[model samples]
Target: MAVRPPQQDGDEPDTLEFGIAALSPHLSKSDLTFPATTDEVVRELGDPAIPYDANGNTVRLSEALGAVRATQFDTQRELLDALHPVLEEYRESGGGILSQLRALLPF
Candidate 1:
Protein backbone atom coordinates (compact mmCIF):
# COMPACT_ATOMS: atom_id res chain seq x y z
CA MET A 1 0.00 0.00 0.00
CA ALA A 2 1.23 3.48 -0.76
CA VAL A 3 2.12 5.31 2.43
CA ARG A 4 0.45 8.57 3.26
CA PRO A 5 1.83 11.65 4.91
CA PRO A 6 0.41 13.16 8.05
CA GLN A 7 -2.49 15.45 7.33
CA GLN A 8 -3.61 18.70 8.96
CA ASP A 9 -7.07 20.15 9.07
CA GLY A 10 -7.94 22.00 5.85
CA ASP A 11 -4.37 21.70 4.63
CA GLU A 12 -2.76 19.54 1.95
CA PRO A 13 -0.31 16.95 3.24
CA ASP A 14 3.31 17.56 2.41
CA THR A 15 4.09 15.18 -0.45
CA LEU A 16 7.32 16.51 -1.86
CA GLU A 17 10.30 14.16 -1.63
CA PHE A 18 13.06 15.96 0.23
CA GLY A 19 16.71 15.00 -0.01
CA ILE A 20 18.74 13.97 2.98
CA ALA A 21 20.12 17.47 3.47
CA ALA A 22 16.64 18.92 3.52
CA LEU A 23 15.25 16.22 5.77
CA SER A 24 18.15 16.53 8.19
CA PRO A 25 17.45 20.07 9.25
CA HIS A 26 18.71 19.23 12.70
CA LEU A 27 21.88 17.48 11.62
CA SER A 28 25.20 19.26 12.10
CA LYS A 29 26.64 19.57 8.63
CA SER A 30 30.04 21.18 8.64
CA ASP A 31 33.44 20.82 7.08
CA LEU A 32 35.30 22.77 9.68
CA THR A 33 37.37 19.73 10.59
CA PHE A 34 38.00 18.48 7.08
CA PRO A 35 41.36 18.85 5.38
CA ALA A 36 41.33 22.10 3.47
CA THR A 37 44.53 21.45 1.53
CA THR A 38 45.63 18.46 -0.47
CA ASP A 39 48.74 18.25 1.64
CA GLU A 40 46.56 17.91 4.67
CA VAL A 41 44.64 15.14 2.95
CA VAL A 42 47.81 13.23 2.15
CA ARG A 43 49.16 13.68 5.65
CA GLU A 44 45.89 12.60 7.22
CA LEU A 45 45.60 9.61 4.90
CA GLY A 46 49.03 8.48 5.99
CA ASP A 47 51.42 6.18 4.23
CA PRO A 48 49.95 3.28 2.32
CA ALA A 49 50.68 -0.19 3.59
CA ILE A 50 51.78 -3.20 1.62
CA PRO A 51 50.42 -6.69 2.22
CA TYR A 52 52.99 -9.05 3.77
CA ASP A 53 55.46 -6.19 3.52
CA ALA A 54 55.15 -4.71 6.95
CA ASN A 55 58.53 -3.01 6.93
CA GLY A 56 56.99 0.38 7.63
CA ASN A 57 56.98 0.89 3.91
CA THR A 58 55.09 3.91 2.66
CA VAL A 59 53.57 4.31 -0.75
CA ARG A 60 54.00 7.57 -2.55
CA LEU A 61 51.81 9.06 -5.24
CA SER A 62 52.99 11.19 -8.08
CA GLU A 63 52.61 14.87 -7.30
CA ALA A 64 49.27 16.07 -8.51
CA LEU A 65 49.90 19.67 -7.33
CA GLY A 66 46.37 20.16 -6.04
CA ALA A 67 44.78 16.93 -4.92
CA VAL A 68 43.32 15.65 -1.68
CA ARG A 69 44.48 12.29 -0.45
CA ALA A 70 44.42 10.81 3.01
CA THR A 71 45.22 7.51 4.62
CA GLN A 72 42.45 7.90 7.21
CA PHE A 73 39.82 6.39 4.97
CA ASP A 74 38.25 4.50 7.85
CA THR A 75 37.21 7.65 9.67
CA GLN A 76 33.70 9.05 9.37
CA ARG A 77 35.01 12.56 8.74
CA GLU A 78 37.12 11.46 5.83
CA LEU A 79 34.37 9.36 4.34
CA LEU A 80 31.88 12.17 4.73
CA ASP A 81 34.16 14.72 3.14
CA ALA A 82 34.78 12.44 0.20
CA LEU A 83 31.16 11.54 -0.34
CA HIS A 84 29.53 14.89 0.44
CA PRO A 85 29.90 16.24 -3.07
CA VAL A 86 28.66 13.07 -4.68
CA LEU A 87 25.72 12.97 -2.32
CA GLU A 88 24.98 16.62 -3.11
CA GLU A 89 24.98 15.84 -6.82
CA TYR A 90 22.60 12.97 -6.28
CA ARG A 91 20.45 15.16 -4.09
CA GLU A 92 20.34 17.75 -6.83
CA SER A 93 19.31 15.11 -9.33
CA GLY A 94 16.46 14.14 -7.02
CA GLY A 95 18.04 10.75 -6.41
CA GLY A 96 17.12 8.71 -3.34
CA ILE A 97 20.69 7.95 -2.36
CA LEU A 98 21.14 11.40 -0.85
CA SER A 99 18.23 10.89 1.51
CA GLN A 100 19.45 7.46 2.50
CA LEU A 101 22.93 8.83 3.01
CA ARG A 102 21.66 11.85 4.92
CA ALA A 103 19.96 9.53 7.36
CA LEU A 104 23.29 7.80 7.90
CA LEU A 105 25.56 10.82 7.80
CA PRO A 106 27.88 12.11 10.58
CA PHE A 107 28.84 8.52 11.00
Candidate 2:
Protein backbone atom coordinates (compact mmCIF):
# COMPACT_ATOMS: atom_id res chain seq x y z
CA MET A 1 0.00 0.00 0.00
CA ALA A 2 1.14 3.51 -0.76
CA VAL A 3 0.29 5.73 2.17
CA ARG A 4 0.06 9.40 1.41
CA PRO A 5 0.29 11.97 4.14
CA PRO A 6 -2.02 15.00 4.21
CA GLN A 7 -0.58 17.86 2.30
CA GLN A 8 0.03 21.32 3.56
CA ASP A 9 -2.35 24.02 2.23
CA GLY A 10 -4.74 21.45 0.76
CA ASP A 11 -2.26 20.43 -1.88
CA GLU A 12 -1.86 16.80 -2.86
CA PRO A 13 -0.16 14.64 -0.29
CA ASP A 14 3.14 12.93 -0.81
CA THR A 15 3.35 9.18 -0.73
CA LEU A 16 5.77 7.62 1.68
CA GLU A 17 6.93 4.06 1.99
CA PHE A 18 8.96 2.36 4.69
CA GLY A 19 10.13 -0.73 2.95
CA ILE A 20 6.60 -2.05 2.70
CA ALA A 21 5.90 -5.63 1.74
CA ALA A 22 3.66 -6.68 -1.13
CA LEU A 23 0.53 -8.69 -0.46
CA SER A 24 0.82 -12.05 -2.16
CA PRO A 25 -2.12 -12.65 -4.51
CA HIS A 26 -2.45 -8.88 -4.16
CA LEU A 27 -6.02 -7.65 -4.09
CA SER A 28 -7.48 -4.36 -2.93
CA LYS A 29 -10.55 -3.86 -0.75
CA SER A 30 -12.62 -3.05 -3.84
CA ASP A 31 -11.78 -6.45 -5.22
CA LEU A 32 -13.52 -8.22 -2.39
CA THR A 33 -17.15 -9.19 -2.37
CA PHE A 34 -19.21 -7.73 0.47
CA PRO A 35 -21.15 -9.64 3.11
CA ALA A 36 -18.42 -12.22 2.89
CA THR A 37 -18.07 -14.94 5.47
CA THR A 38 -14.71 -15.21 7.18
CA ASP A 39 -14.05 -18.55 5.58
CA GLU A 40 -15.10 -17.23 2.21
CA VAL A 41 -12.81 -14.25 2.42
CA VAL A 42 -9.91 -16.34 3.64
CA ARG A 43 -10.31 -18.91 0.93
CA GLU A 44 -10.24 -16.22 -1.71
CA LEU A 45 -7.37 -14.29 -0.15
CA GLY A 46 -5.31 -17.33 0.72
CA ASP A 47 -3.50 -15.83 3.67
CA PRO A 48 -2.00 -12.85 1.89
CA ALA A 49 0.75 -10.96 3.68
CA ILE A 50 -0.24 -7.92 5.74
CA PRO A 51 2.50 -5.66 6.99
CA TYR A 52 2.04 -4.30 10.48
CA ASP A 53 4.93 -1.91 10.81
CA ALA A 54 7.74 -0.09 9.09
CA ASN A 55 10.15 -2.92 9.77
CA GLY A 56 8.00 -5.27 7.65
CA ASN A 57 6.61 -7.43 10.44
CA THR A 58 3.52 -9.13 9.03
CA VAL A 59 0.47 -11.17 9.80
CA ARG A 60 -1.49 -13.16 7.27
CA LEU A 61 -5.01 -12.00 6.39
CA SER A 62 -6.46 -15.21 7.83
CA GLU A 63 -4.64 -14.64 11.10
CA ALA A 64 -6.00 -11.12 11.25
CA LEU A 65 -9.52 -12.38 10.69
CA GLY A 66 -9.04 -14.91 13.46
CA ALA A 67 -8.13 -12.14 15.88
CA VAL A 68 -11.50 -10.54 15.42
CA ARG A 69 -14.96 -11.62 16.60
CA ALA A 70 -16.86 -10.72 13.46
CA THR A 71 -17.60 -13.75 11.32
CA GLN A 72 -19.16 -11.86 8.46
CA PHE A 73 -18.45 -8.50 6.90
CA ASP A 74 -21.27 -6.62 5.20
CA THR A 75 -19.14 -4.09 3.42
CA GLN A 76 -15.55 -3.33 2.54
CA ARG A 77 -15.64 -0.54 5.09
CA GLU A 78 -16.84 -2.93 7.74
CA LEU A 79 -13.97 -5.26 7.11
CA LEU A 80 -11.46 -2.44 7.34
CA ASP A 81 -13.05 -1.05 10.50
CA ALA A 82 -12.98 -4.42 12.22
CA LEU A 83 -9.43 -5.11 11.21
CA HIS A 84 -7.97 -1.67 11.96
CA PRO A 85 -7.62 -2.12 15.69
CA VAL A 86 -6.20 -5.60 15.33
CA LEU A 87 -3.73 -4.33 12.81
CA GLU A 88 -2.85 -1.38 15.04
CA GLU A 89 -2.21 -3.61 18.02
CA TYR A 90 -0.04 -5.85 15.94
CA ARG A 91 1.85 -2.86 14.64
CA GLU A 92 2.41 -1.31 18.05
CA SER A 93 3.38 -4.60 19.64
CA GLY A 94 6.58 -4.60 17.62
CA GLY A 95 6.38 -0.97 16.55
CA GLY A 96 8.18 0.73 19.48
CA ILE A 97 8.24 4.47 18.68
CA LEU A 98 7.95 4.59 14.94
CA SER A 99 4.60 2.92 14.60
CA GLN A 100 3.16 4.86 17.51
CA LEU A 101 4.33 8.05 15.88
CA ARG A 102 2.92 7.01 12.57
CA ALA A 103 -0.46 6.49 14.20
CA LEU A 104 -0.58 10.19 15.01
CA LEU A 105 -0.08 11.21 11.42
CA PRO A 106 -2.89 11.54 8.88
CA PHE A 107 -3.35 8.92 6.19
Please give the lDDT score at residue 34 for candidate 2: 77
Write candidate 1's Cα lDDT for 2-106 as tens digits. Answer: 124466665754443232222222123333234244445335444222111111111132122122344334444554455445434443443345445664778
> At residue 85, what lDDT does model 1 achieve?
52
Model 1 lDDT, full chain set: 0.35
CA lDDT of each candidate? Answer: 0.35, 0.67
The TM-score of candidate 2 is: 0.62
lDDT of candidate 1 at residue 44, scale 0 to 100: 44
Model 1 residue 22 CA deviation in Å? 11
List where candidate 1 sits over 4 angstroms from the true fold.
Answer: 1-74, 96-107
